[model samples]
Target: MRTPFFLILDAIIFIDVSGCQWRLLPKEYPK
Candidate 1:
């Protein structure tokens, strides 16, 4: 299944705020 737009946005915001790499995102979110 494909990830939702909101979820992807949230993940991006989280990464930006946390200053973490894309690979570091939680498994629940898409890579």
Candidate 2:
């Protein structure tokens, strides 16, 4: 399934702020 830009941005921000690895981001469909 396709993913949303906002979701990707949020994931990046969250990872940056929380210092979480990119691979640790949620796997759920963005849209």
Candidate 3:
């Protein structure tokens, strides 16, 4: 199944706040 738009957005916000690389995102999130 395709990832949801809001979930992707959440991932982006999380990355921005955490200052982490995209590859470091949790397994539950899309790349």
Candidate 4:
């Protein structure tokens, strides 16, 4: 159903934002 599809999309967006935030930090900074 549409609800399930939207839930999956929301999860993917959350993951993408976390990854982008990590990548955006200065490379010299340790993880």
Candidate 5:
């Protein structure tokens, strides 16, 4: 499925703020 750029960006921001690993991101989020 083609994911939205903003959603990916938001996910990145959320991860950065939360200090979560990239691999920890859910499959639904950006790769």
Candidate 6:
């Protein structure tokens, strides 16, 4: 199943604001 657009977008923004690395994101999230 495909992930939700907002969920993916939120993940990216969260990482950006937190200054976290992409590698830190959960594997379940999109690439």
Question: Pick by lDDT: which candidate is best?
Answer: 4
Question: Considering TM-score, which of the candidate structures 2 and 4 is the better prediction for this target?
Answer: 4
Give the alpha-carbon lDDT of every model.
Answer: 0.71, 0.66, 0.72, 0.83, 0.70, 0.71
Q: Write the per-residue lDDT of candidate 6 for residues 1-31, one digit (tens) a residue.
A: 5579988998989979566555466654557
Question: TM per model?
Answer: 0.50, 0.49, 0.50, 0.67, 0.50, 0.49
Show the colliding residue pairs in model 3.
none
Q: Please give, for residues 1-31, the per-residue lDDT of candidate 1 as tens digits.
A: 5579889999889978566545466664545
**Residue 23 error, candidate 6, Å:** 17
Which parts of model 2 have CA positions greater than 4 angstroms off? 1-3, 20-31
Per-residue lDDT of 1-31 in model 5, one digit per residue for the tens?
Answer: 5569888998889979566555466654645
lDDT of 3 by residue, 1-31 (tens): 5579988998989978566555466764556
**Clash total of candidate 6:** 0
Worst lDDT run of 10 residues, candidate 1, spans 21-30
Cα lDDT tens digits, model 4, 3-28, are: 98899999999998788778787664
- Candidate 5 is scored at a TM of 0.50
What candidate 1 gets wrong by more than 4 Å, as runs, is 1-3, 20-31
Model 2, 1-31: lDDT tens per residue? 5469888998889878565444356554243
Q: Model 5, which residues run further than 4 Å from truth?
A: 1-3, 20-31
Question: How many backbone collisions does model 1 have?
Answer: 0
What residue runs in model 4 are displaced by over 4 Å at the alpha carbon? 26-31
Best model number under TM-score: 4
Scanning candidate 5 in windows of ten residues, the lowest lDDT window is 22-31
